[model samples]
Target: MFKRLYCNNYRGLVNFEIELDELTLLLGRNGSGKTSVLDVMFALCRLLDGSAKVTDSSIFPERTLTRWQGRKEQTFELDVELDVEFDGSVQCVPFTYRLEVEHEEGGRKARINREILAANGQPLFRSDRGTVQLYRDDHSDGPMFLADWSASALARVQPGPDNRMLTRFADFMGRVIVCSLSPASFATEAAEESERLGRDATNFAAWYRHVLQENPGQVAELTSELRKVIVGLDQLSLVKAGLDVRALMVSFAEEGSKPYSLRLDEISDGQRALIALYALAKLTANQDCALFLDEPENCVALAEIQPWLMEIADSCGESLPQVVMCSHHPELIDYLGHENGILLSRGNGGVTRTSKLKDVSADGVLKLSELFACGWEQ
Candidate 1:
């Protein structure tokens, strides 16, 4: 699904690029900057959603930013270049944003240095001072600010002379779902949460119940898939997940329970993981989509991983939709047959260097555990 990824000046990543394939699995030890990779992908979606500022999308957050306050800091930059093909034609899209911070008479200030878009191999738009010129097919108008603008606003008033992959990728994210783990997906209604909780599942119970009543089919399908992921899991059920009495309430499977309150804490880690997996799997099973699971081993038990991976490979393996995950599971590597799908993280002095397993040598493949244990090297 994700053909390639390139990022610069983003936290642990300075300049990075790698080729990706369907079923790509990125493996690295903790702090190998694996989580950062997921962060960047989500940041990409946020940009397309117009919910995050370019600076906010950066790895260098304002609160944590500390770079010799007395001296000038080099500009922070983020660039995402992608190759996407749709309807039989491939297109190259690049999104680059640059910001410079300097002390002005003892006060720190930030200014944009480069904001440009290139299609194929040529520049479509460049912003010297926030002046953006998106191409003709672009639905964005003028100098857009994702931090403060809405999609409807951009679609209604964007300049028509510039184009960037973000233009289409932005549109794709609305329909594309990328999530880690939110409580509501498996929360019990009476337990104090709902389904489809906004991004974080802060109010999970109410949303879960409401959706079950509104779209019972979606919930039923999700439950069915979850049961498959969790071996020997039969009679799967959700507690206090939907709404009740025109007001929000949780539903439970207990005897004589009012089904008004459900808590995420009640579920096991394995169950919670399955909930996320199934929810996304259900999506791919229904639409032309791709699922990205970052470090799926988080809650999924090591024993169940192989069966689960095979399950995904068999069910969606042929067509319609697909699933690609980044994992560090050894059984997963062995089950997949070829280490070619594996992507190792390696670099010079840096803590991360991610590339496919197909590139690893005999030692690298034979002693995979040692390689993962070594973390990173020169």
Candidate 2:
């Protein structure tokens, strides 16, 4: 689970730090940098996992630098707690990963200045410029080499018997899921199984196919939960659509009549969102995964929001290790704000700031959401 995050000079986030819990809620107005936090996490995960490089403009664009600040360097740090096995015993370890990227020539180009990974305040991997130093599980230096400054040297490290700790951290980062579901972009057809869901979940069918293959027994549990949110939902199956292609099909059971089926894309947006949300909770449970959800309540019915939130909340710390969600819905705010919410606000010059929801005092008559809606929480 992620323990804390520190970011400097990345868009509106300047010298920002936030402590995370098993479940955290990000609440604020549209431009409070709630989504920016999620974006940073997602981009960092991709960078560390070798899926993206430091120079990828889509992930880290020229605009990544804070506009008001003249600094050319951006820094990010993540602290994660994990139960790691070594020396024939399992122990909880604290790992810290830090990255610094510098912009050059008026911010048109960027390169990694420093990248470091430490465990229990001991360096396991450190890179400065093109020089790299790799350490072993016993905290002794193993190798020193020069790597590409634009890429992650840690990602390129192969798994070895003495580097289990480093490999474990890499695997954990790879499993982190960040998403803002757009039901309209979801495809009904899947060309092949996907290892992970896309950021927008456009390849949901492909990812779902992979989930079903990995956890066949969980299908029944997923269907049972889907029935609660999607009325009359009987079962979900993948049918052959074409050569090496499969399509997701949803079946509904009706009273006094034969069950009817429909393609996944044929469902309403709300229904599709509900399906994705439920699958997210069930499939990823107990899998040592971290989830970041942006506005999951979108397209979901008012009555359904709390139940889904409850489901995700209950699974945290046990089945799911960490979850960070962003939302402004009353159901979410009233239910989780006081306990788990982190309020993000823009300070002078639009630099993002963080505060606890419980710290804000409000009149007894107004709920947390009401206070926020009426600008009392501001």
Candidate 3:
């Protein structure tokens, strides 16, 4: 689980830092940098897991630098706590990972300037430009070599008995899920399995296929939960559409008629969102994966919001190790603000800042959402 995040000169997040809990809620107005925070985490995860390069324009464009700051350096840091089995006993370990990217040639290109990963204040991996230093689990220097300046050296490390800690950290980062679901972009057909879910979930069918293959028992539990919220939902399955293509199919049972089925794309946006949410919560339970959801309340019915929130809340810390959500819905604010909310605001210069929701003073008459709607939070 993420204990804290620090970002410098990334978009509006200049010198931004936020402490996180098991279940944290980000509450703010539009353009307050809530989604940007999620983007940074996702991009870093992708980079370190070898799925994306630091110079990938789609993930880290030149415009990602703060517009007002003339500095060409952008820095990001994360503090994570994980429970690991060490020396035949499970122990909790604290890890810190930091990366600095420098834009060159007037922001036309970017490369990693420095990257470091430490466990319990001991360096596990360090890189400066092309010079790299690797350390083993026993805190001894392992290897020193030159690495690609635009890619993650940690991702390229080979798994070995002496480097289990480093490999475990990499695996944990690979499992971190960050997404803002766009059901309209969801593809019904999947040509092959995807190990990672897309940031927009456009490849949801392929990702779901992978999930079903990896955790069939969890998929069954997810289907049972979906039936309660999704009207008449009987089962979810993947059927062959072509020689190597499969399509996600949803079955519904009616009271006085024969059961019917529909393609995933044929379902309404709300139903799709609900199914995705339920699947996300159920399939990843107890998997040591952290979830970051951006505005999950969108496209969901007002009445259904609280129940799903409750489901997520019930799973956090036990079934789900950590979850961070961004929302503007009143149901979410009233239910989670006082306990798990972090209020984000922009200064006059457009720099983003964060404050704990419980620290904000209220008249005790209006709810947190009401205060936000009336601009009291600003």
- Against the reference, the lDDT scores of all candidates come to 0.48, 0.90, 0.91
lDDT of 1 by residue, 1-378 (tens): 355566554555555555555566666655666566666666554544555444452422433222323333324334434455555787655544433332234333333444454444444444445444544434434353432211112222332224334455444443334445554343344443332333333344444454456556666666666555544444333433336322332233444543333234555766656555554555345444555566565667777676667667766545324455666666655555254354545466563566555555545345554455564321
Q: Model 1, residue 256: displacement in angstroms?
A: 17
Error of 2 at 250 (Å): 0.9
The predictions' CA RMSDs to the true structure, in order, are 6.6, 1.3, 1.1
Superposed Cα deviation of residue 233, candidate 3 (Å): 1.0
In terms of TM-score, the best-performing candidate is: 3
Runs of candidate 3 exceeding 4 Å displacement? none
Backbone collisions counted per model: 49, 1, 1
Q: Write the per-residue lDDT of candidate 3 for residues 1-378, one digit (tens) a residue.
A: 899999999999999999999999999999999999999999999998999988787567678989889888999999999887878998888999999999886666788889999999999999999799999987899999999988888899998989888888899999999999999889999999998888898898999999888878798799889998988999998999999999999999978889999999999998999999898999988778899999988799988899999999999999999999999989999999999999998977999999999998878899988998998876
Runs with alpha carbons beyond 4 Å of true place in candidate 1: 55-60, 63-113, 122-126, 138-167, 175-179, 182-220, 228-264, 284-289, 314-324, 336-346, 363-378
Ranked candidates, highest lDDT first: 3, 2, 1
